[model samples]
Target: MTTDTQTQPSSDPRYPVGRFHKPQTIDAVAIETGLKTLEELPRKLRNAVADLNDAQLATPYREGGWTVRQTVHHVADSHMNAYIRMKLALTEDAPVIRTYEEALWAELSDGKNAPLEWSLQLLEALHSRWVMMLRSLDDKQWQRTFVHPEHGPVSLQTGLLMYDWHSRHHLAHITSLRQAKGW
Candidate 1:
């Protein structure tokens, strides 16, 4: 099981990491939207992420960039945080969540040197846990709120969407890198 402590800084401005976005409310999570996102995720991302060899996973996007391993680790970390946030919101009052420096976290040796196998295993387990958690949400749990230090109050439902997007986002990054290398 991965901890929620890891995160990566986004050099890509469009996907600023660790930022909170308000969710449209539990009533708005439209069953179709969640189901559609859920159905597409494994089908779309499995081959992109799973087919890589160890060397491919270790390949950094650029000279100073994070490898695929770090990206997946970031995913596990971020989702783990999301799950915890949901739990907290359901059990306690709107809690002010903790914040960390993503850049600093990703720069750690573990982030740079972690094996691809470690990250892949983390992803498999993390996604399993996340899906189970999301599926178990009641209407109230889905609407639970968390007070983010930077982004203010955001709903648990939005956090789920963020993770869904996160899965696709990093899958795209890895697939793009593979294409660039003509692998």
Candidate 2:
């Protein structure tokens, strides 16, 4: 018989799907406030994740899906890419951020087999550097723009807001999955 795990989707998709479908739109003031919230996100996420054990971290909500380790690693990878994009935007005149096949990255061996500790460490370091980058940006730097081939024009402000949204969204997903499984 097919179990619940066989029928369900990964928790990460529950909220972040909206971000993928609806591109971010925000004003500078909103971006500033959102960036503040984003800066606090790593500590909040680490706190939330602290209660979950390695099994919980490794459990896939569904079959043929990523476990929590993969999800955390994906966050690190995604944030690293965003940090690089922000740097490019500040340094270049309307640079286009390079896109990669996210699905392919999600399927790599590390994604499939890495220990939860590695993903957690990556998340910690990635968020540390990303927050530093955000904190260092002046108003002009925050306003820097880049063209994403798929998402059209994106500003560092909007990207920061999106990253803020990203952290909470994934945290919610993780919480929901844990509740569903009573873990």
lDDT by residue for model 2 over 1-183, one digit each (tens)?
Answer: 112111223334554324422233445566565566566666665665677777787786456556776676677678778889988998899898789876689789877677656766767777777777777887788778989999888878768767766766666566666777876
Off by over 4 Å in 2: 1-13, 16-29, 51-55, 62-65
TM-score of each: 0.73, 0.77
Over 157-178, each residue of candidate 1 has an lDDT whose tens digit, in order, gives 7666666557656766777777
Instruction: State the displacement of the C-alpha of residue 13, model 1, in Å, after optimal TM-score superposition.
Output: 9.2
Error of 2 at 145 (Å): 1.0
lDDT of each: 0.65, 0.68
Query: Which 10 consecutive residues of model 1 have the lowest summed lDDT?
Result: 1-10
- The prediction achieving the highest TM-score against the true structure is 2
Cα misplacement distance, residue 69 of candidate 2 (Å): 1.6
Candidate 1 TM-score over all chains jointly: 0.73
